[model samples]
Each structure stands twice: as structure tokens, then as C-alpha cells.
Target: MPDHDEAVAAALDSYQYRLLPDHIHSHRADPTLAERLIDSFLQQLARYADRRDLDIHDTLAELHQQRIDRGGPDHAPEYSFRLGAQVQPRQQPAGDKAGNPLWRGFITALAATPDGQAQCTVRIPGVNQALHLTTAELEPADSLLPLPTRTAGIVIHAQEAEQTIIDIAARLKRAAGNGLATNEHALADLAQLTMRLSAWSGGQPDAIMRHLYDRIINAAHPPPQD
Candidate 1:
């Protein structure tokens, strides 16, 4: 589980990787489309205010004018796509944004990895150029990946959430005896649990369960006889 802040952070991260536009310049060039995109972004941003902590005050018009003057990090005015209710707008430990060069790319593929991470391939603007970046590296501003509303349906029903905790405990018992680690289902369920826990506990259980899960996974899978 993540705290309100951490969940908020992760949501922002997801939006960057799964929402933002790939070819921002094209939208920037089209006045009508660009305006619409900004409006959508603002509306979505406002909708999530009850669930998030954003510090935005300006409207679509102000943001547009700011973009025209300041542009993005590269100094070109470009607009990103509409973020979903579960998506966020900012990232933490934002060191990469400070100096790294961001490339415009579209996520070509997504796959769940054995190590509990998502593997994604991205197609850059130029022909025949693709980059392998995971969900951790992808962001709405840096890549164009579409996330469906199907995910928004993952509401935290009280009974279901309680059952999830019970299920996770049972799996831990199995892991201990089986010397288990890297179960795909366990990882995915844990991730979803974190998201739901954020809603239930406002992030109180996030760190506790996360640390416990890591310890169990490590204990279950010790090094083989070498």
C-alpha cells in the first residue's frame, strides 16, 4: 500500500507512461486541437482533485499561454494527452526531468515480466527506432501509451479488500514452504492491493505491507547451493 502522497506519485508516474502524447509538436501546431487537449487535461485534473493533491490554479487558457511562452523542457510548446481519473501529473525524485533529454515515442508493446515488472517497447519518432523501457521509466509526457477505462473500474470494495489481505497471507504461507519467489499472480495482486489500500487507509498500510511482502519474497527464495 502507498500513502496518499506515494499513491499520488505512482498515479502521476502511470499517467506519464500511459497517457501523454507521443508527438506533442503536432498538437502544438494545430491551434484548435491543442486548445481542446489542454481543456481536457484541465478538466481531468479538476475531476481528480478530491482524490489527489494538485497545485494547479490556472485554467486552460492560462496554461496554453504559458506553454506558448515557456514550452516544455526542450523549449517548444507542446501539449500532452488527457489523463484518466486514476492517472497523475507529476513525478517524484524528478531528477531525470532536470537534465536528461526526453525522446518522443509511442509504446509499441507491453508485457508482464517474471520479476514483477512490466516490459514495454517504444517506437520513437524516426523510422526503425525503438526503445525498451519499463513502466517505471515511461511517463505520460515522455511516451504515448493508452490506458483503458477498464482499470478505473478497480474500486476498493471493503469486503473484497479484506479478502485480498487474507489471500495474500495464504500465499505467503505457501511461499514459505515452496521456497517461492517471482510468482506473477502474487506480484500483480500485490500491486493492485497497494492501489486499493491507498484508497482505504489513505496510505497508512502502504509501507507496512510493502516491506512485509519484500521480506517474505526474499526469505522464500534463497540462493541455491552453489
Candidate 2:
């Protein structure tokens, strides 16, 4: 196995021993032990990289790139890296050739409290937590839906024209996980969601979700601008 795969092998070996101590010994006499060991090593390496806060996806991408760089009839396939003699480089997947994946917008929602000092509450699907945000200076006085007293929202695919109906756990903090009181993207760029009133005034989760259905009618449909 390659030096780069040692960590993965170590991790897998540790797991294998825990599950079946005799398994390694049994494989010791098998002709395919070396290849299986290599596969185990790679998996272990990925896990270690994840624990160390390393970007394993990027690591894998780099590995694939390296294979491409060494692209001649001298390498093996990813699954069969050591199965046999050198082979031609693997071809890129069909998806890569297709235009960039049209990601259905990541679903999100916005809700407001009826209290006088209401806060804008945003709940994203799949995330266990509701991101509580503050919009003290962003809510405009003349906007149709006045930005609540001190609440905020992120505009993820706000223009996708699809409403994501999601049920959020109560503010009881039981069903909820963590809260993001501040905006993650506070700077306005071409593709970023910021907190500035002019930038994110229309980004309230509710408003964004409401617009999704219109996208089906016309993606070029425009929303009220700040």
C-alpha cells in the first residue's frame, strides 16, 4: 500500500480487530488481504482527517487530480487501485460533464412573534437549531412587511420561488439545538447573504419561501427590491 494510505489502514485495522480479532489473521493467509487492507487504510485515513478538521472532500479531490496528472497507462482505478497491472486513467463521471448541478434551493423559513417587541425567527430544514437573528437596524419603515423590532433572516435561495414548509420546534430550547443571533454573511457581494438593510431587507425567510412558487411560473420574475 502507498504511504498516504497508512493512516486509513491503521484505523480500519483497529475497527476490524474490535469486531473480529481473528479476521485479520484469517486474511493473513488470503491472497486478497493486501488489497482489502489498502481499502481499509483509505477509509481510516478519511476518518482521521475528519477528526482533525481536515477537508476530506478536498483531499479526495486532490487525489483524483493527482491521478489525472499522472494520467497515462500507469495507474489503476480507485476501487481497483492495486487489483492488477497498470491501467488507463479512469474517465470523469457523466454528471461532471453535465452543466453544474441545479441544486433545489436549500429549504428555509422565517416566522415572527406577534408581541410588540417581536423578533424575526428563521428555521432551516435539516438543521436541528433555529437561527435566532437580530435585525435592529435593517427593518425598513416603508416595507410591506415591516422588519420586526429586532429579528433577522438569511436569504438562501430566496429567489428560487419555492416555499419550504417546515415545522420548527418551539422556542422551548428542547427541540431546538443552537442559535445564530448574528448574521453569518454580513457583507454584500454578488452571491452572499448579508445583514445590511439594503442587502438583506428582502431576505426574510418567510418572504423568500413565499417567492419559491413564483419561480415555477418564471425564474426571471423579480421580487420587490430594496
Candidate 3:
């Protein structure tokens, strides 16, 4: 019988290749299995963190920092996606001078490979793209290629929608500038486009997943060996 850790890792791997939201959602609905998978994955991540003398919260924070750094050597290639929960602006008190309040949330990012470690890069120049993880650095979760949510029901759908938006924006950026565009503007455009697309479809989750699995993944990865 497969051990629980193996089972959890397998489920996480499945997320990487899952091509459709319906397929993911079909599995996720009322997820007794997902719960087990999630618990096990968290435990594994925790263990990895402990081995590093780190914590899960800290690890997630490091991922956030990596996004900010856009990883790599000085002037080396770097990139990341901007997505995640957003805080709704609270209504200002009637007596207050300003009507607007600030919104806040976490956004994801990926640092590109540093120059000397070109071997770490998985490139598709035709797609005008590449991705990298630090040399010898172990990741508890996948490198945010596809953001998997642990939540269920509407929350899960929402997280998936957020991920799709990020993926689509990335595609549009490559299409527009072949990945040479500035990261700030590119991320902004992606945010706007994802929000619009999500609203337009009333959150038809599968469209985003389909576009990514069918179109984007090829551009992100190298061709397989003959």
C-alpha cells in the first residue's frame, strides 16, 4: 500500500498536469481525499521547514520575498506573477474627509535564474520565457507554476480563478512583448485582464485552466527528448 506521504505527493503532482477546472473541481468537491492530501503535504512541508530550521509561515514568507527579488544575480533575468486575495475597502466614516480606503492582499512572484546557473533554467526562447529554482534549494510545494488552494467550495473556485488570471496575463505578456516588457506594467495588465475575464465569464473556471494546460505549459517547458 502506498504510504500517506507518497499519496500526498502524488496528488500534488496531479495538480501540475490537471488540464481542466472541472477535472480539478470534480476531484475537489467534498474532498475527503483532498483533506488527507492537504494534511499530508502540509506535514511534509513542515518537516522540510524543520530540517531547514524554518517554519511553514516563514517558508511562505520566503516565497513572497523571492517574488520581490525576482531571483538571480545582478542584472540577471527575473520574473514573477502577481495574484492572490484582496481586501475590500472599508467604508469611511461619514465625518472623514477621504472616501477611499486601502485594499491589501498577498500576490505571488517567481525570481528568474541567475546568470551563472543557466543550467537551472528551463527555457523556451520561442515562447520567450524561462523559469528557475535556486540551486540545491528544496521546495515544499511546486514553484507556484499553478497555485493550488487548500480551501473548498466557493473559496477553492475563487483561488483557481485567481491563478487562471495570473496565467492568462503571462500569456498576454509573451504575446505582446515576447517577455521583454517591464515586470510592473506587465503584472498590472495581467491583473486587469484577469479581473475582466473573470467578471465576463461569471467565473467559468475551466476556461483559464484549458488555455494554460493546452497553450501556456508548452511555452514554459522545453520539448521532450525524442
Q: TM-score of each candidate?
A: 0.23, 0.23, 0.22
The list of candidate 2 runs beyond 4 A from truth reads: 1-19, 24-31, 73-226
Residues 1-226 of candidate 3: C-alpha lDDT, one tens digit per residue: 4365566556665753453335444334447656655666677778888899875785576566554443323423443222332212223335324543222222233344555432233221112123333422211112312223222112223334445454545465465666464556445544444444344333323444444454455554438889
**Candidate 1 lDDT (Cα, whole model)?**
0.45
> Over all chains combined, what TM-score does candidate 3 have?
0.22
1 against 3, candidate with superior lDDT: 1
How many clashes in each structure? 6, 9, 3
lDDT of each: 0.45, 0.34, 0.41
lDDT of 3 at 18: 56
In candidate 1, which residue ranges exceed 4 Å CA deviation?
1-156, 207-226
- Residue 66 in candidate 1, Cα distance off native in Å: 44
Q: Where is the poorest 10-residue window by lDDT in model 1?
A: 81-90
Residues 1-226 of candidate 2 have per-residue lDDT tens digits of: 7453566557656766765687637443554875676577678779998899988886476456435434432342332121111112123435334342211111133334565332334332112123443222111111111122211243233221112111111121222235534232221121122222223223444343343334423433335689
Error of 1 at 91 (Å): 30
Q: Lowest summed lDDT over 10 consecutive residues: which window, candidate 3?
A: 137-146
Error of 2 at 41 (Å): 3.3
